[model samples]
Target: MSYADVNGLSMYYREHGDAPVTEDNPALVLLHGGLSGSDDFAALVPELSAHRRVITADLQGHSHTADVDRPIRVETIGDDVAALIKHLELGKADVMGYSFGGGAALRCAIQHPDAVRKLIVVSFPFRQDGFFEDVRAQQRQMSPESAAFMKQTPAWELYERTAPRPEDFPQLVGKMGEWLQQPFDYSEEIRGLQVPTQLIFADADMYSMQHICDFWALLGGGQRDAGWDGAARPGAHQLAVLPDTTHYAISSSPALAGTAERFLR
Candidate 1:
């Protein structure tokens, strides 16, 4: 339960695994999804920390971290992660993010590549249009009023219990909805990234298979299958689609944790 003064906010972050993290075993920063908190990664953190120090943080307006005057945007939140890393005095660290956090992770890698050693993006699309038709349709129709139903969910309970202003739930939802409505495309930027990366998603993720292939292709994957000798492999970037999972369940899958562990190592 530590907080770092970053980007004009006291960002909440938790450290795990062996202390006195060193360059040989850099920390692994974990970012939770939208409307979710650092607790979302609790189950996975131990496994991750077994190999290296794991740092989990609440994104703005989630759980222990309160919202600021700025609107909810991945780019800004990503910058916040970079700031936190510097605040903690780590030279660089591997970063893993889930869902909306995945968006922030992508932004951090693009905007602060020098601060990142490896990148892991789970269950999120690079571009706004990359989401499935139904997903985009849902986002388009989402509103603060529509968010009323979420009050019955765990996200609501967590927000009410831990938010700096519990009553701000609706306001947070409203801003998130508004941000999702805007179109975004980071294809070019992702293509230019030099960081080693891993992409994980549910087989039934919000993105279509074609979209995932396109994403892999942009990262120099799917161009051609590796030969028997595995001599023609593309960049170190890799993609994994977890089995029998949806976007909601993918984050909690043991398979995701295993894949991430292997990738980070």
Candidate 2:
């Protein structure tokens, strides 16, 4: 376990295994889902770190990383991840994030393209409205008061176990609620991205399938067919919808790790 002083926060991060990070074999940085910490990737890290160094971090307001005065916005978290990369002096690493982390990873690639080699975004929508109405409603209903209910959930358990200030859980919930309620659409930004990227999602995610397809289209995918000789392929991007998985469980799915490994290779 380690902490990097970046972006005005003591960001918690840890490394698994060891490997020479080269142009052909870059390091992998992982961002976990909302309300989850670095340990959220326990199922995927071992396999992923087997051949390369895997870096996992607890984002702002989550786990051991104490929150600062800043709001919990994806853009800011993305910048923090980029700063951490620079702080560690790892040049051009591959970044993969899940759900909330996916948004941050995408933002990182957009805001700091030079720091990333390739990107993998899992189980997160590109637009705020991409989520189903029910999910959106739930997000809007969240508040600091909801902390009482969260105490019965696994997220709260983890928070209680690892957060530097466990009493701030309510404040964290409030910040997330505010951020989730805000409207956002990154269609133009995603279309303009130059980084090689991959999109992963569960067969039944919280977001609509139509929205997911639109996201792929924005990445220059699903519009045409590649030639039999593999000469007419689309952009260097890939998409995977894992079977028998849901948004909450996609990050832990073995298929998720396998697909990501193939894409990274």
Highest-scoring model, lDDT: 2
**Predicted candidate 2 versus true structure: per-residue lDDT over 1-265, tens digit per residue:** 9999997899999988888877788889999999889877998899999999889999999998999998999999999999999998889999999999999999999999999999999988999889999999899888999988988899999999999899999999999999998889999999999999999999999999999999999988888887788665557889899999899988899898899999999
Candidate 1 least-lDDT 10 residues:
138-147
lDDT per model, in order? 0.88, 0.93
Q: How many residue pairs clash in all the candidates, one count each?
A: 0, 0
Stretches > 4 Å off in candidate 1 = none
TM-score of the candidate numbered 1?
Answer: 0.97
Candidate 1's displacement at residue 159, Å, is: 0.8
RMSD of each: 1.1, 0.7
Q: Provide TM-scores for the models.
A: 0.97, 0.99
Give the range of the ten consecutive residues with the poorest summed lDDT in model 2: 226-235
